[model samples]
Target chain A: AAGVIQSPRHLIKEKRETATLKCYPIPRHDTVYWYQQGPGQDPQFLISFYEKMQSDKGSIPDRFSAQQFSDYHSELNMSSLELGDSALYFCASSRMGPVNSPLHFGNGTRLTVT
Target chain B: SQQGEEDPQALSIQEGENATMNCSYKTSINNLQWYRQNSGRGLVHLILIRSNEREKHSGRLRVTLDTSKKSSSLLITASRAADTASYFCATDAHAGNMLTFGGGTRLMVKP
Candidate 1:
């Protein structure tokens, strides 16, 4: 099975536009996570999904939402993108929500909001 | 506020030398993990040390945890230029399933 895959490696959008990022997790992984990283900064958790349900919601605004399908593919949707939302969005997957297991991450999708 | 904080915001070492980084957390944790991130790249897991374990080793990497003091250290032996990257420490507290990351330690290895 392939690793986590995120679509649209790079995107440029105007303010107030909507952007949807897609992710396909590896086979057999039940947990998915979303993180955002700014330039020269560490990644901050946004949200997570388990068993097609939203498990955790971090310090994200209301404009950000995510959905996990029956097949385990997840989509992160931004209803109204803002300049502050411009950052690298990363999709990650893990076998379970354990402290010891490492989270496998996709390359990331760079969103540019002008 | 962030739970984890790493000392020495940046580090520089010559090739074949050892590099050490420290992380401190404010709350009790179940485990602590280290991650490496190259320029413009996602983070890669390096190692994890549980609260019960005093030390853990994998290859040239050694991690030590002192839960009493709420601190941890990552030591990399024989570092190379490829090891040049930003390293982050994440803490998984007992109450939460999510891991919160520290600011980070930027390591620069000279060849």
Candidate 2:
């Protein structure tokens, strides 16, 4: 089975720089979710999209934004990156149903902001 | 916010011994799920138990949910070193909603 795919297994940036992360969800999956995990911490929800529309929002920073394309692929754009933004960024996808379904996650992108 | 809180933040056990982790949460939920993650890796879904269900078994993994107590547990039978990882419980309180993850329990299985 195909799993969620995230680009740039690792990323490095200086403060005030911009970075964009991409995600390719599993085939036929209609919902995409983004999470940030600090070292030794559980994953924290950022934002989510359903059917290419903004569905729910979480603790995502104001400097970060995301959108799901027609192809079901999503992108997370971060501007003026800060050191606190350095963490493992994960993308998960699932088939939307009457009840929440399990999420398929990617290996994750390790972002290091210096 | 319905965040799951795991007990005994860390556990160490010998191989072949059973490992159990507990989680407590506030608020109502529709379902609860468990996940495992290796160091610096993506999360792997272990099992999910609906709020209405009491106990469920999947292979060597057993999950028990007590809605009345607002708690759940995951038990891995005959654990191996490969099972050494962080275990987290996540709660889905609503349909089509994101899960609230617990702090996670780090389990280390001795070879």
Considering only N, C-alpha and C atoms within 3 Å, which residue pairs clash in candidate 2? none
DockQ of predictions, in order shown: 0.60, 0.68
Over the full model, what C-alpha lDDT does candidate 1 score relative to the true structure? 0.87
TM-scores, each model vs. reference: 0.95, 0.98
Candidate 1 per-residue lDDT over residues B55-105, each given as its tens digit: 999999999999999999999999999999999998876333567888899
Error of 2 at B10 (Å): 0.7
CA-only RMSD, every prediction: 1.6, 1.1
Off by over 4 Å in 1: A97-100, B94-96
* Second chain alone, TM-score for each candidate: 0.95, 0.96
What Cα-based lDDT does every candidate model obtain?
Answer: 0.87, 0.93
For model 2, how does the per-residue alpha-carbon lDDT over A1-114 read when each residue is reduced to its tens digit?
A: 898999999999999999999999999999999999999888999999999998889899999999999999999999999999999999999999877789888999999999
Candidate 1 docks at the CAPRI level of medium
lDDT of 2 at B40: 90
Clashes by residue pair, model 1: none
